[model samples]
Target: MSEAPHRDVLITGIGLVSSLGEGLDQHWAALKADGGPRPVVDRERFAPYPVHPLVQLDFDRQIPKRGDQRQMEAWQRIGTYAAGMALDNAGIKDRTDILSRTDMIVAAGGGERDIAVDSALLTDILAASDPGRLINERLSSDLRPTLFLAQLPNLLAGNISIVHKVTGSSRTFMGEESAGIDAVRTAHARVASGQSEICLVGGSYNAERLDMLLLFELGNYLWREDWLPVWQRLSRGGGLVTGSMGAFLVLESPAHAAQRGATPVARLDGVRAGRCRRGPGEATAIARRQFDELVSGLTGGERLAVFSGATGAQPATSEEQVFLTSLRHADNHIPIRAVGSIIGHGLEAQFPALVALAALAVSHGMLFAPLDDSGCEADGSAPIDRVLVTQWGHWRGEGMALVAPAG
Candidate 1:
């Protein structure tokens, strides 16, 4: 007896909301515009620490009920809204039959902190002789049930289920960038292995919050003062300029999509992830091994484009540069684009957003222009058949994926 053939996982729909704007057409137009895509930086709002703030959106367009919108925090609302857009794009928004079986996997961080209550508590602590008691009293009284419930990371998935009616088996991952990578890897594996016919997978980030900024600042991970492109930031002591964004994708087996006459945006050929200690060159070695495995049998003649999720943070970003250099030397100079330069880093949402961009490039048959004058990016005029997405987390996690045109 012969072994069964492998199933193909197709990306049928993508929903993206970032500083560049919302949806597929908006992003494509912004990247392909004649002026080469201006970075939408909010230098005044965050002041010294520049950020890419999300454009205003009408929540009623996706989340019909005001009551539902009122309960979720900003991150949950963004993820729910993006998830609804994905279902709509997949042409199955109201199809109870299909939605009843669609699996969901979300990658997210803990809920946003209530800045007002936190500020009041901190101020009162300075005057109180018993700071510990004051803190405890405030925690017991000031934290409401709804606010406490909102802090759960899984609430993003719950909100998606409540708003979109995707009541399938749900899972959520909580590590930063690695969480996003694993979410996509798990979704792709399940559908490709026939365990699931379809899956909705992705994550979102709220970068405009002061609490998040304070956390990163404590670790000295945030970029400050001037705004520079991702690649150019290395010279100024590399640090992350986080962004507010949400990204989601609908993945399905080829046979399942065919049964419903749904068109595919691109095919997810492979997904690979790894992690290592910050010891000297371990991250690059891990990435190299994953890259070799992901593109094992591809021919040298194939046109390849690379979408790098380099967050402009210290050693990780620098190490990713080395890995990319090796790829250029090995592949005779493949075009590379540092996506964070355009949209800023989205932490948990970074990987999914890059994958969505790769799928868009594959479907459109062209790569977006270089984002900076760092000499790392080059213009590509030839049609592209495959795109490689790379992610090196600001601290740990290394991952890569291959995206190609759907047959």
Candidate 2:
């Protein structure tokens, strides 16, 4: 019998961090156990608002270094932590060594979370001003700098590039929640086109405060009151009320990894994405194409373990369910894991985490169950594993990834 030909673009490393914990192990454990971390709302930042269930992370404690800390923001810190983990996992001690021959694609979501110029700071400034105070006394550069570097979303990728000395095509993408998947697609294309040998792709977002939530409240994008727990009724899901963190993946050409004797972590068969018309069933149309392109990308008669982008949102998750139910031949018996329930929707930073999780499942032969929020259907008659993950209604996109059997 002839040997099966090698697939292209193998994922070599993954780094993920959320409120449940940091690193792949924490994410893996959280998923296996199905944990749902709540939001962090402090009286100081979010005056009068109580803390609810969220996936908040503290980068200060996780990354302790003044030199590395000079201009880094929370999300960037998270991204750096995950990047270090990924590089270490891949057994590449020096990023400069890899950059000499490879490319870097840092997927990012959300602007830098700098409390200095945030609403909280502005409020403090206004409160401090007294009518009797002199005009000059009311304003100072110390109070607010004209230009703050943390406001830019690309700061994470820039920091990673600076630390790694990555020269080949170092750039960042902002696709709101789809940035992570977009990063993988970009890296995959780069490797396929022989532009570079290895590509670092991932994204991060950390919402440690409730300013975003306030915005969500105003925009009416958050889940309605009925979706919130009794205690969280006052809080809205519109903004960054979840966690603060980062996740990343390393992609290398299959031939390159094999030739260098690098252990293949997982195979990335193919990736495809598209948009549909806006309307009632538009999500289904969009998702159907997304699924078809992804599944059809497979070459041989390969079995599939699907990772659905079920965000727990009523409209989105419903569409995802409809699309998954339509998969042909694959018995609904196949296990489907909704990832966002554990991590919340990393928003734009989401796809990177999803890609990393999918790679982890493929490499380890394990899938984290989807969060089991109220609206989910749990009957076993459907032939789907429908493993109710410990997490709950936190998915956001209508996409999925398949894992091929190990070599």
Candidate 3:
């Protein structure tokens, strides 16, 4: 028996909603504006810690039903909306024949908590004789049944299914940034290996929540005081400022896309994901290995740029900086842009968002301006035919993907 022939995976559609705003044109305009883009941050709301907040969206445009909107939490709504946009962008929103077979791979984190219920429980538990019992009692009585169901990470996938009708085999991943890396990897591999024809893959993060802020602050992973570019944050102990973003991509096999007459945004040449002990030089080594494998397959001399998902979280960010610097020293002086500096870190959604931006750049035939004054980012006026997107998770996981213009 002969093995199935491999196919090329092409990114046909992209739906992105972040601090810069929604859709490809809006984000592209913001990043390519004459004076360079200004970070759309809210420092007073979250206080000390600044965040890139999502722009106002009319839910009715994507999610029409009021009942559907009422049932979903913010993250679910964002994901579902983005998924719909991806389908629409791919010109298959109402094409039941195509959507019926579109697979879905979502990278998500646990849902937002009910802060009021949590506050009351904490207050009461502190005064109760049996704190454990008090907590259980409050959880059972104070929390609504629907709220618990809403908090499940898979609900994002469920909502996407219900709202957008992408009801093919659905899988959801939950490990922070790595989850995102694996989601895109799985989607690309499935399409390229003849396992699936098309896939809807991505995730969303709501960084404006109090619970999320408190959670990361507890880990001492948040920067205090005002905002700074991701690269500059390293000078003063690095920290991550989470953002509210939802990113989704419609990936299709080249044959399938051509058969349907769908245009390609970019070619997803390769994706490599790995993890290692946080020992010195370990993360950089993993990234170097991944970078080598991804680029080894490419025919040389393409003008390249990098879209780095370097969350301003210490040690990891510093290590990634080292790896990027080494790329420059190795005579591969690709211009680098740490995307987290603008949109802020979206955790599970971060990788997909960066990939979307890379696709936009390659499709446009140019790279956006440098995001920071930190000498790490240099201006690149040359045409970019290929882009390398890197994601080094704040705590663990390292991954990279090669995106190039579709022939």
TM-score of each: 0.96, 0.75, 0.96
> Looking at model 2, which ten-residue stretch has the lowest summed lDDT?
384-393
Q: How many steric clashes does model 1 contain?
A: 0
Count of residue pairs whose backbone atoms collide, per candidate = 0, 21, 0
| Regions more than 4 Å wrong, model 2 | 1-7, 34-64, 113-151, 223-241, 297-303, 328-330, 368-370, 373-400
Global CA lDDT computed for model 1:
0.89
Q: Give one digit per residue, the lDDT tens place, for model 3 in 96-211.
A: 89889999999998877878888988888788999977766766678664555434889899988888888899999999999999999888888989899999999999998999
Q: In model 3, which regions exceed 4 Å deviation?
A: 1-5, 144-151
User: Per-residue lDDT of 1-407 in model 2, one digit per residue for the tens?
Assistant: 01112346777777777666666776667655635323233334444332223344544443556577667766677787777667767766474666666677776655543445455455655666453353234345333334354346677767766665555677777655555656666777777666768877877765555556665556544543322322122223322234455777778877777776778667665555444443577767666655555556554434455555454444445555655555533454444444443455566556666667666665565454434443232222232211111111233333334434326
Clashes of 3: 0
> Per-residue lDDT of 315-362 in model 1, one digit per residue for the tens?
888878878977877775488999999999998899999999999999
